[model samples]
Target: MARIIGVDIPNDKRLEISLTYIFGVGRKTALDVCRDLNLDPGMKARDLNEIQVTEIANHLQKNYNVEGELRRTLAQAISRLRDIGCYRGLRHRRSLPVRGQRTRTNARSRKGPKKTVAGKKSVKK
Candidate 1:
């Protein structure tokens, strides 16, 4: 069970896809890492030797912020926005969509389960 950057990526998966198990690393970044390191992206994580694993860990630690650090950095940015009290910040503060998406009918995912009033009835004119 090889671990990288404190995350246990699946050993049977392809290197490029396994790399995405680390937070903040997407498919493009994983491909770039493979290109930069001259590694075979199609190789499985279990097939990698110790040197290759170490190279990936070192490269990620040196050039990217993942896991806890990335999470903290994002939290700080959102906190800064909230402190500034901007429109987006207000939306964040209210647990509403921050990207100007319609909320009248959709946004149930963000707004959580529906809440209904007791004995509420609709009347037709």
Candidate 2:
């Protein structure tokens, strides 16, 4: 495993794919980084020399918000929204889907396990 930005990326995977193991780095961003650093995207992570690995780490740290920094920035943004009491924030606060997903059904992943309410029943003589 190659440690980059405090994350251990799989050595068996290609450089571009391995880079995605780091938070906030997607396929496109990984490709861009590889291009910018003049590293071969198809190269396996284990093939990276120590200097190349350090260069990648430095480049990412200097030019991008990633790992802990990216996580903190996102958390701050969400907290700010919650503090402002926006509709999205309210949804986030309530642990509901914030993207207009219907809570009537199929949001169980976000809404968690179902808490069934007793249904009314009537009997007539």
Candidate 3:
């Protein structure tokens, strides 16, 4: 395992994919980091030398807000929205989809398990 930005990336994965183990870094950012640092994106993390790992760690510290920093800022933004009572904030508070997806059909992920409400017995014909 290679520890980068406090996250232990999988040793067998390519450097670019392994870099994505750090918070706030996606595939695009990982590729960009490799390009900027002149590191080989195709190399496996297990093959990284100590100096290369340290260089990557130092580079991330200097250039990016990741892990705890990113989480804190995002939490603060959500709290601000909640405090201001915005529609999106309310949606977040309610645990529903926040992107205006129609709740009438599919939002099972955010809406949770279906609650079975008993209906009135059918009237006699």
Candidate 4:
């Protein structure tokens, strides 16, 4: 395992794939990092030398907010939205889907399990 930005990336995966283990980094960003650093994207993480690893860590620290930093940044953004009392913020505060999702049904993942209510029984004539 290669520890980058306090996260242990899998050693068996390719460099680009392993780099995505860090939060805020996806395939495109990983490829960009490899390109910028002149590293082989297909190389396994375990094959990296100490100097290469250090270089990678330094580059990420200087150029990107990843791991805990990215999480904190996103949390702050959501908190700001909540403080503003906007519609999206209200949805986030209520733990509902913020993006105009149909809450009438199929939003159980965000709205949580169904809270069924008793329906009125039919009265016989």
Cα lDDT of candidate 2 equals 0.94
Q: Rate the local accuracy (lDDT) of all candidates.
A: 0.92, 0.94, 0.91, 0.92
Model 1: CA > 4 A from native: 118-125
CA displacement after TM-score superposition, residue 89 of candidate 4 (Å): 0.8
Best by lDDT: 2
The estimated TM-scores of all candidates read 0.90, 0.94, 0.92, 0.93
**Local accuracy of candidate 3 as per-residue lDDT tens digits, 1-125:** 87887899999999999999899888988888898889999999999999999988888878888888999999999999889999999998999999989998899989999988999999998
Better model by lDDT, 1 or 3?
A: 1
- Please write out the lDDT profile of model 2 over residues 26-85, one tens digit for every residue: 999899999998999999999999999999999999989999999999999999999999
Scanning candidate 3 in windows of ten residues, the lowest lDDT window is 57-66
Clashes of each: 0, 0, 0, 0
Give the distance in Å from residue 89's predicted Cα in candidate 3 to where it truly belongs: 0.7
Q: For candidate 1, report its TM-score.
A: 0.90
What clash count does candidate 2 reach?
Answer: 0
Clashing pairs in 4: none
**Ten contiguous residues with the weakest lDDT in model 4:** 1-10
lDDT of 3: 0.91
